[model samples]
Target: MIPIRAYVAADFAGVAELWRAVFPDDPPYSRAEVAIPAKLAVQPQYLLIATDGERVVGTASGGYDGTRGWLYAVAVAASHRRQGLGARLVQAVEARLAAAGCGKINLQVRAGNADVTGFYESLGYCVEPRVSMGKRLGVNAGGTGTSGP
Candidate 1:
């Protein structure tokens, strides 16, 4: 059986590898880039991972802005997909957010990715039919740069 736990500093490599496997369009995030920064920026209580021993098979990150929490970065390993790993990761993240007193959990999957949106919907996320627009400001949240493989 797979197990869920808090993300450790060393688990970044596995997380990055999983990210690479799941998102083929974009380059994978380097462990060195997302590990320490995510550990420092992401709340320890919100970063949940699923593993078989030291290998991270799945991961999900939750972010809270006091009122609501954004559940993002949910990914499962190539070999581990369709084994409920994705749903488990989401449930774990949701539990953590609920424990932290978050009123609502929000997530946005691409419209073109009907499969992904359906998965989220099956897990109780409703369609937020609104114009979700964005702009690149600089580095950090605004940068046009994406996580490299």
Candidate 2:
């Protein structure tokens, strides 16, 4: 198994290809070309990838928000699944979050993606009763980037 490492600019194409294959339902804005740079602008170190020599085979990203941490984009290529890469990816993010003083970590699996619930559960994650919500900052369609606007 390839050891996981931080993402590099050179890994862009491979990562993009891997994500397109793994998450075919993601929206346009979430495409690797758009999302990768946005993430790099912030906490790039938390963005990790596993590669087989030159091909990206896995990816996982984490975020620390002082009080809570989030695990995002945890995916392994279908060809690479069932070989413990998924578990390792999650564990890498968990280790980083723990190092940053995060006591709790949160992740959301789409309601339709029940198959992944068990995968996450095996990593010690549980489905909490709290509702998940989000608003893309600075976006159109009613949001104006101001709380009072």
Candidate 3:
């Protein structure tokens, strides 16, 4: 059985590879080699990974800033897809956020990604009628720019 657990430093390589495979078009900040470790440094418990023995098959990150919670970088390995691992990862994040006293949780799905949007909907997330905007900060790993929104 696949086990879901908090992400450790050793999981970075596997998680980064998984991110590249799952979100090929994601911005540089989202796919950077330092991203996972950076996030873990802030809130290690919020970064969760699912493993089939030693192999990393899924990952999710959650954050709470008092009033609101956010979910990010949720992915399940292609070989592990359709087995509910994605949902499990999401739930794990949600539970963490809720325990942190977060009232509302939000996430963004790329506009053209219908499958991903539907997956979130199935988990009780609804699209809010609001404009999403972003601004880049420093240099990104790919030398493009930072990613937000």
Candidate 4:
């Protein structure tokens, strides 16, 4: 099994590349330069990466608000998909959140991302009756997200 472990300083570049390929539609604020430092300032340990020795092929990060856990930035390289790496990345984050006293976990997938819905369902995630809404605050307000790469 490929090792799933906490993120390290060296993972930034590898992760940036992995996400760029895996999630081409990701918003700017969620870019590596912004997200990495922001995550490191928070519960950094929840950021997990799947590595084959020196290459980062998968990534997932979680957050525990003391009640419900949040999952974000889950991605696996195109070549690594269908090999159980995505599920493993998510499971690793779930394990960490559970250890932190999180009773339930929540994640968001953009509307119409049906392709991945089945994958999450297989992992026991079910759709709930709630309409998701959000408002950008702070630096994300203008949608610039962050400065250039």
Candidate 5:
């Protein structure tokens, strides 16, 4: 059975693996890497993992700007693609954000990624021409995600 849970210390490696499988071109980072770890530790509640019994195959990281919710690092393993794992992870993250009093969720997709853009649109997200402009909270955001990456 597929289970989604809060990111635990033991699941770090699996999460990193999932990230690589989803975005092989990007450099992967260790969970204990100081930068990302510090940021995530402060808001562990916002990081989520999807697993088939301890094997994390999907991940979603959310950032809140004190009002709206921003989603990032959401990726499902290639082997698990198209089985609704991506959508499921987003739903789980958004649910938590809603409960935390976030007004709206915002994300960015690179103009080149048509397939990924379609995925977000199907989930009730519309394209906003505005570019993502923000100072990193000194966090370990693997890449920019205006919507889902």
Candidate 6:
């Protein structure tokens, strides 16, 4: 079994590379090195990584907004998929959130990504009757400051 542990500053590059491999279509924020450290400064414990020896194989980022817990950027290297690493990452983050007094956890998967949706479903996540929305507060890697659902 791979070992899952709290993310350290040195793990950023490895994690970012893994994210790019697993989420080629991810938004710019997902690959932002600056934003990542900013998040780590807030709740470092919520960011977790799984490694094989010295190599990072998976990652999961989580947060608590007092009322609820949120999970994002849960990714496993393509070469490491189907080996339960993703589930382990989720479990690790869930434990962290739960210990932080969060009562419920929420996550979002892009619509039409059935494979991803099914993966989460297999891990006990269910689709909610709600629409996912977002607002871009500033320019992203694409250099556009648009906001919408």
Output the number of the lDDT-best candidate. 4
For candidate 1, the per-residue lDDT at 73 reads 77
- TM per model? 0.83, 0.91, 0.91, 0.93, 0.81, 0.90
Which 10 successive residues of model 1 have the least lDDT summed?
140-149
State model 4's lDDT.
Answer: 0.89
lDDT of each: 0.76, 0.86, 0.85, 0.89, 0.76, 0.83
How many steric clashes does model 5 contain? 4
lDDT of 2 by residue, 44-101 (tens): 9899999988889999999998999999898899989989999999899889989989
Ranking by TM-score: 4, 3, 2, 6, 1, 5
Candidate 5 colliding pairs: 107-146, 107-147, 108-146, 108-147
lDDT per residue for candidate 4 within 10-101, as digits (tens), equals 99999999989987877788889889999999999999999988999999999998979999999988878899999999999999999888
- On TM-score, the stronger of 3 and 6 is 3
Superposed model 4: Cα runs more than 4 Å off: 143-149
Model 1, TM vs. native: 0.83
Would you list the rank order by lDDT, best first?
Answer: 4, 2, 3, 6, 5, 1
What's the residue-level lDDT of 52 in candidate 2? Answer: 85
Q: Which structure is stronger by TM-score: 2 or 4?
A: 4
Candidate 4 at 98: error in angstroms?
Answer: 0.7
Error of 1 at 18 (Å): 0.9
Task: Give RMSD (Å) of candidate 6 vs. truth.
Answer: 2.2
How does candidate 1 score on lDDT?
0.76
lDDT per residue (tens digit) for residues 60-110 in model 6: 999999999999889888888998999999999999999989998999987
Q: What's model 3's TM-score?
A: 0.91
